[model samples]
Target: MTISCNPKLIACHDCDLLQSLPDGEQRRGKACCARCGAVLHRYSRDSIDRSLALALTGLVLFLVSNLLPFLALNAQGRIQDSSLLSSSLILWQEGNTFLGMLVFATTFLFPLSSLLAILYLLLPLRLGQRPRFSIHVFRYLQSTEPWGMLEIFMLATLVAVVKLGDIATVIAGPAMYAFALLILVLAALSASLDPQLIWRRLDPRCNH
Candidate 1:
């Protein structure tokens, strides 16, 4: 007789307790740790496909958000429209170089990098192929998520709009809507992603 250990074992990140995961189909709800009540996993159906779609959508929206005018101000019969890149550049030209770069990184660079990284990781996985530097790309995605700041930037933009409305006629632009949608889509994508699943798929033993 031969004894075999279950291959679906997972160790809790919080408590480091080793346990076996249920079959994929059985994990409809969140799996919790027996020792510490930590959430071990939340199985999302077709997560890679969903995340890929969202990442692609977010990329398009991101482009529109950067290219089009975010807002237009009509004051004293003069109109001025500001795009994201122009705004950052204006800040830089005004000698707020540090603030400008910070805005650029948080608003534009990090979010774009995250979307590209997601696509790089998920697209290959969806096609039943492995991406090069998969672990590094996934880790980059995780680290960049905190710095995306689209939601925070949008909130600040809304506040500015309200304040400026009293002084000038403020018109919201198409880019604003695209940016808002991008934020929601990115949030959903993040939620839909299962790091454990990706890690498992990336494992050579599991792949074989």
Candidate 2:
């Protein structure tokens, strides 16, 4: 989504104060809420460039989070470490196929797809080419938004730790910590994205 900075009608996201976009060369593209410091529209000066960097980082972290052991437990000198995939497999083995599929879809599939879709949208746009599947990819990301389920995964992790505490000592692994933070950053970035801005840039005549 793309936006042409309208200097005449800026509204504060927090306080709802209406004002004008700032005047002068220095304030040309800067956006700030009129009554509060809240940002209404924001873009990295080189948005496509930054999005690619973030997408690559997110991809690597995602791989580590899924492939490496997510957590570890030690009891009576016996140790166990399991990855996210391992957990899903365990769930399936325990006669919880439906639940296993739920975990797989929400925790792994949707979030990864969203990140990849964002990359597909931004990378091409950054390179001065139109996004190959801009609208469709954006729609997929939007649909997957509610199903990302990182918070649910964290809650389940906590529950597992508590349940296992009586039988074992748990040690959080690097992958566990990384996945938690990656979920947070990904959620933040997705929330901050304004599709209207991209659409405007993509089509000058579309009213958003």
Q: Across residues 1-208, which tens digit of lDDT does each residue of candidate 1 receive? A: 1212344677888999988877876557788999999998888988899989999999999999988888999999999989877767889899999989988998889999989998999899998899999888988887777898889998989999999989999998999899899989988888888887888788765543
Best by lDDT: 1
Identify the runs in model 2 with alpha carbons over 4 angstroms from their true place. 1-50, 204-208
Tell me the whole-model lDDT of each prediction, alpha carbons only: 0.87, 0.74
RMSD of 2: 5.1
lDDT of 2: 0.74
Query: What is the C-alpha lDDT profile of model 2 across 84-162, one tens digit per residue?
Result: 7777688889999998888888888887898888888887777667766687778788777898887788889999999
Q: Estimate each model's TM-score.
A: 0.87, 0.72
Clashes of 1: 0
For model 1, name the residue pairs that clash.
Answer: none
